[model samples]
Target: MVERVVATEEAIQLINKLKSIHGPLMFHQSGGCCDGSSPMCYQEGELKVGASDVLLGHIGGSPFYIAADQYAYWKHTQLIIDVVNGRGGMFSLEGPEGKRFLTRSRVFTEEERKELQL
Candidate 1:
């Protein structure tokens, strides 16, 4: 099956590093504002997800989600999580690691859409 969210090699490496320090982790796409669309990483259970959140998929064994309202606007695209040199969300695990998680995306191809039954 095609993945709705995936990570780049560099991102996977960073994720492993963070996991080594923080244990397990999760990610949430910030809607905007302070963090803009940056992906926020948290140790599992550090952040609580509720009915307003939608799990897009997993990257590096970590579940990734987006606010339901944001999902509505992004449902047609697949999320590609990557790591870049910069600061991350203030509370994200990667913030102090000198790297930030970024979101790159592409419109789903017809075949993928069919597989996803979108």
Candidate 2:
């Protein structure tokens, strides 16, 4: 069985706020800068899950989904997403043994940060 890391309380609140306007929250990770880690939120139906998909449970009542392949890689990963205050939003992942990586974006503008608040 695949293990799932629960979304933090802050993440849950942020996702709920986004769902109020955008509907279900969609999550995806991909190979990119900062040790091959990336995560983004989109409007409902923006993401398509394949047969091998893994349901990661809901974050603040919003369905949180992820790809099976990606889950395999993130099995023991920890993610921290922040949007509160004016510090912009960022996504970071740390492996089981403390290895960590941040999103590729050097800095997020006000609008961009708000858009990806969750």
Model 1 regions more than 4 Å off: none
What overall lDDT goes with each candidate model? Answer: 0.90, 0.47
lDDT of 2 by residue, 1-118 (tens): 2223345555666666666766766665544444234454555567676777666654455444556777565544434443333222143211221322222223434554455442
Candidate 2 has an lDDT of: 0.47
TM-score of each: 0.95, 0.50
- Clashes per candidate, residues 3 or more apart or on different chains: 0, 0
- Candidate RMSDs in Å, in order, are 1.0, 13.9
Model 1, 22-110: lDDT tens digits are 99999998588888568999999898898899999999999998998888888888999999998888888998889999899999999
TM-score, model 2 to reference: 0.50
